[model samples]
Target chain A: MSTKHTIAVLVNDQPGVLQRVSGLFGRRGFNIESITVGQSEEAGLSRMVIVTTGDETTLEQVEKQLYKLIDVIKVINLSSKPMVARELALIKVKAEPSARPEIMGVVETFRASVVDIGTANMMVQVVGDTVKIDAMIELLKPYGIQELSRTGVTAMIRGNA
Target chain B: MSAQTPEVRSTEQLREKWLKPEVITGSEILLRSLLLEGVECVFGYPGGAVLYIYDAMYGFEDFNHVLTRHEQGAIHAADGYARASGKVGVCIATSGPGATNLVTGIATAYMDSVPLVVITGNVATTLIGTDAFQEADITGITMPITKHSYLVRDVKDLPRVIHEAFHIASTGRKGPVLIDVPKDVSAATTLFQPDDRIQLRGYNPRTVPNKLQLDKLARAIEEAERPMILAGGGVIYSGAHEGLYEFVNKSGIPITTTLLGLGAFPSGHDLWTGMPGMHGTYTSNHGIQQSDLLINIGARFDDRVTGKLDGFAPHAKIVHIDIDPAEIGKNVPTDIPIVGDVKTVLEMLNPIVPYAAKADAWRDQISKWKAEYPFRYVDSETVLKPQWVIEMLNDTTKGEAIVTTDVGQHQMWAAQYYKFNQPRSWITSGGLGTMGFGFPSAIGAQMAHPDRLVISINGDGGMQMCSQELAICAINNIPVKIVVINNQVLGMVRQWQELIYDNRYSHIDLAGSPDFVKLAEAYGVKGLRATTKEEAQRAWAEALETPGPVLVEFVVEKGENVYPMVTQGSTIDQMLMGDA
Candidate 1:
């Protein structure tokens, strides 16, 4: 019954606000897959998108508990609505003369762009859904991925209806 | 424009005419804010960090401050006052150890939804997070426990913070609120505005029940053949006793209460089925399990109340009405969850509920169970039974005294024996079950209502934990009757060990303790000891007659355990009726 959920929370941009929000999740035993926070359109407010995995009951509790926090203004389960979710990853792969052409072909197929090229390595930037990004990483793993940095998923509702 | 004309006057003149603001020190503003909130007394411990506030407290005619022996005692006293008087209680402590000492009491109040405004003085703003002397991050530590907390970095925000603390503490599923004031903020000066209302955007509590939900609930209650009312602390907190009484009387539904909801309805009422949970009455527990419709009011389905989660109230269609939305369906699946004040919802439903004829067969079944498995204990001529002593106390006080208790076997016994007639008459540590809460809380109840009789029923083991508060009663002449049921062991733990762990009593035997009579005498309070039933009666009479505080020690039979106990993970029906 465990499934993934994307929840967006709007909170005041004050000291210890993030700690208050995340600490509640940690205490309540919610497993956070990833979390990303940024300034919202409203002044002095921040938006946080948390990807968590839990049963339906626990996810409902998570939303109720989030609203209990003092700094939290609003909470929305992005998965319940029509939304777009994306993650950005910068993956560096070791590319020798023999593997350079193969790595380029794989990156092109995934619609990724090479941000930096080195003699021994090349850093490819990929922006896609989590599944697509994971697929790209798996495809480049045989070419020897040296290092990787990923920005957790950020989500937005789809339409203005 | 002539200078002498009224129209030529400056804009400052218009502002000053409409809003009168006086410059005052933060300490003075704090006192003024408390006065504005209608606070008459505060239980507090003074320290170096709070010297300025204490200095401002001097010669303050509006407030009466009781200095407690320890910070923990102060907070517990405040909690008791709030619980017994149905008003927001205030407590103060300095930073570091003083603030940390209140952690347990704060958590206790938080669990029980006692309204308390706890103020702690922190080190100067400059020394914060620098590990300065007597510096502690109390706000951060109490964030999860408190309904809301404020750290006043600026003196200008002191008045507003204090107002908000009181508002948050007393309103909307009431709980404790903390305000941490830095020493510098206390010493600084700011414009004191007397009537600035709080406006927190995210802090609105739902007070009115949905009309459609009420209609559904009323129809369900009318349609069900076997319906019961399970009341909790929210009944008392929302002052819904009158509404509850009216509803139950009109509908003729059998009523059962949680431990904290002891006094919400009169124990002597014909429709009362007694408390429900572990150590609850046989009829009450069995009735809940067999009922077709269970309407829970204000009480969360705590694990203790629901022994085996899957089998608890298995046949009931649950209708949970609570002020806190988070508590609804948090523990057990609820069929109808109505989030609103209990009083409001009950008032709305009282008129709408179609009165159904009394189900005689259900009542006859419950009466038969009650008669068959009544609360029982063997009376011995040689040793006094704790139950007899409690019954004697109840007989003498006529169940009118404000009774507080420490946690253990004694607490459960008191709950079973005491016949409470009104709300706020029975105050005890319910949720957290703090061991040393009785004596200090009794002091608080006594202080709140000086003319009323307040008794603290404690076990010898739990009493010793905070026995130092006895001196506060003696010094202040707060005449609170203290009764220590001396069984010479941690009775509840020993009972568990005996039943579950093969009677291997490890460190549970608390024998050869200090003579409680002598200890009370040492504190210059009257000390009485009773070894027999006649002697206990005489001692109770003497303690009641004495004007000053009295401590009565009753030596009773050891190894006495609370009965109708549901073993861990067992269903409510599977109870071990001990020694019956």
Candidate 2:
């Protein structure tokens, strides 16, 4: 029953902190499956979003464990919140000139973008839920997919401040 | 009135009563609540923004903290904890890098369906989104991996969010949850209400199995002859071992557990065929291949389980019972789909399926196959076989222990040798094939079953991935026994390489490693070295007697592979055992 969960952590911008955090997870043999770091709305502080999964008691332990780390200021379980989660994918498909229009029709239906176009290949960008992305891939398979890439899922809580 | 003169209270007492509020930092309150709720420990890293939480932790001596090498490790530790304990694991990371590091661990946990709560600190409330120094769009980064997520802009939301995270993590399908807190929120002043109350639409999880679905499932079971039971991690999650056991016993159908479902069916049970899939037992392989009806309970048809999808159980009618509706037809097509917890599903279906007492002929056929290809090690002549170590541990522990395993040959060896007589006694990373899962999983398992002996059967290669975890055990006094099968190579991959690529051993060999005994000493934990059968037995005996965390390093011969292995690109019948 080892399922992964995503977590967003807020901390001070400093050195040796990332090591400390990741080390804690590894040291516990907790799988820090994936993590993304970037600028937050707050100045001086950084936001780290993580995805991991465990049981309720274990996660409660993790929350308490995280509070003990000196560099970590606050922690959030974004998955338990009422929020919106999404991911982006860039897929390149090959189509004959004659079938180009048909491909465009499907793209328009999903509100996707034709980011790049070549004589025989078209690169389209789509952003939505994972299911939507998967559906798009399945639809484009008939048209011949050349290459595909995805920016893993990201999320934001719903409602205004 | 004159005798009883009214006395004025001291200024300090009046000030304490009238002005001094019962003060506690948000982080400390959070930690205290978690401890009160039976969270004895947590895993995480520290940062500037989260300094307040660390300070708050100083006051609560009841809670133990294991500082990970990274935030990702903290999340992973929580994952391991949750997996082993059957409860939501918790971790904390600072903003930016700290929070970001938790992403991979969270995603891993999400895919595996482990319940976890991750907490991160952000900058003060007023300075949000100013292109802050350590700030990042964490909520945005974690969307796909979590069941749900939360960002708390105010202090009042902490208790509710935490409560919700715990509930969601333990309930339903179970996955990870996150909460982002601004720095000021941790320090903000607010009335302390320890009561956790939260109400949300579209968030209710089913606690009881749907009866209609159960009826349909019973109908499916009643019609089958050559039936197969496919068990998954969900059975463990639902704690439905008794119900599942009763149903399987009454039906007299052989059980084939998945990698995640290993311990769901007691290994020692006569009806327990074995694991099914690429590396599954010949009995399980044949059972799945020949079955006319497949009853999949709480298990997904992972590629390893359904190799060469077109050829997998082509004639079987699959009846899939799961809590997640999305999983019904996601992997393999289903003839009948029942969505609910396995425990409830089995309970309701237990009565409907009449006691068709004895399938003596079918049971005899299965027993014949089981005898022909019992899960046994052919190469017992080696100097130090990992399988023997696992067998000895199993014997010594008497099936009353909780065992966690890291990925690779050692894991499979443990699975094959260890007799898990009870449910929830074995924990590992089945979905992700994640390495380094054992040490921390044992830590969490030990916490959950304080009196039970917890053992981490680890491979040299996998253990090296997070050897630092030993330090956490040492510092926190979590007395998990670590049995490292020092094969000096990545045994599973090495086996694959030998079997397929002509045995040109590449980077898989590890001729050099730190002295494990010294390594344990450095971590302030006890160490035992074993090379022979006697040494191993003696070491294990000593380990059992030890009071604190101990590492027993067995210098097993290199290139010792798990046998009775079904080679890749071959049918289940075409197995490659020792000397074959």
lDDT of 2 by residue, A1-161 (tens): 55656677787665445765676676555666566676778886777777677875556556645654434777888778776767789999997789889999999999998999999999999999778999999999999999999876666667861
Q: How much RMSD separates candidate 2 from the native structure?
A: 13.4
Error of 2 at A6 (Å): 29
lDDT of every predicted structure (CA atoms): 0.89, 0.77
Best by TM-score: 1
Q: Candidate 2: which stretches are off by over 4 Å?
A: A1-161, B1-25, B32-38, B68-73, B125-131, B193-195, B207-210, B356-358, B380-382, B567-574, B578-580
How would you encode candidate 1's per-residue C-alpha lDDT over B1-580 as one tens digit per residue? 0123334444466345324578878888888788768787899999988989999988655567888988989999999999989999999999999999999999999999999999999999999999999998998898878888888998988877888888888888899999998999999987887656977766788989889989888888777778888999999999999999998888888899999999999988877888888999898899999998899999999887888998999999999999988888789898988999999999999998866465567777877887787788888899999999999999999999999999999999999988998999899999999989998999999988989999999999988888888888988899999999999999999999999999999998786789999999998999999999999999999999999899999999997989979988998878888886
Q: What TM-score does chain A reach in every model?
A: 0.97, 0.78
Model 2 C-alpha lDDT per residue in residues B69-145, reported as the tens digit of each score: 76755776777677767777889999888889888778878777888888888878787779688988676677556
Candidate 2 chain A: 10-residue stretch with minimal lDDT: A62-71
DockQ of each two-chain model = 0.63, 0.03
Candidate 1 chain B weakest lDDT stretch, 10 residues: B1-10
TM-score of each: 0.95, 0.73
